[model samples]
Target: MRLDKFLKISRIIKRRTVAKDFAEGERVMVNGRIAKPSTDVKKGDILTLRIGDRETVFEILDIKDNVKAAEAKNLYRIIE
Candidate 1:
């Protein structure tokens, strides 16, 4: 799935546009490399999101076009 969509569907960023902007701003990385908003993300990929002075990492667990709010957390596993 697209990075932006995954972020939103997973409820990590709340909105797709915000996730796109965040990725375009170079605040996101995939597998140790900076990624764009349209980047392809798959299972097992590591994502690092820079938020101010800290970073949050997650491992993609699954991908789906749509998911219930309660099940969103199942899409990815927080690494840190």
Candidate 2:
């Protein structure tokens, strides 16, 4: 899945456009390197998101196109 799509589907960023903005601003990283919204993401990949002074890390556990709100967290495991 694309980074932006995953962010939305997993309910991490709430909106795909917001996720794209975050990536365009260079606030999103994958596997230690900065990533773009179109960047491909898959199981086991590490994602780091920085917003202001806060940072969150997650490990991709699964990918799904459509997921229930309550089940979104299952798509990624928070690492921080």
Candidate 3:
């Protein structure tokens, strides 16, 4: 799935537009390299998001076109 779409579908960023802005502004990374809104995302891929002074990292566990709020967390596993 597309990075922005995945983020929105997974409820990570809340909205697809926000996710696109985050990626276009270079606040996102995939597998250690900078990522764009259209970057491809798949199971097992690592996602790194830089927000302000903090960095959030997680691995894609699954991909779904749609998910309920309660099930969104199942799409990724945060790596601490």
Q: How many clashing pairs does model 1 include? A: 0
Candidate 2 lDDT tens digits, 25-59: 99999999999999999999999999899999999
**Residue 67 of model 2, lDDT score:** 98
TM-score of 3: 0.97
Which regions of candidate 2 deviate over 4 angstroms?
none
Each prediction's Cα lDDT score? 0.96, 0.97, 0.95
- What is the per-residue lDDT of model 3 for residues 1-80, given as tens digits with 9 covering 90 to 100? 99999999999899999999999999999999999999999999999999999999999999999799999999999995
* Winning candidate number (lDDT): 2
lDDT of 3: 0.95
The 10-residue segment with the lowest total lDDT in model 2: 71-80
Model 1 lDDT, residue 72, Cα: 93
* Model 2: how far residue 42 lies from native, Å: 0.3
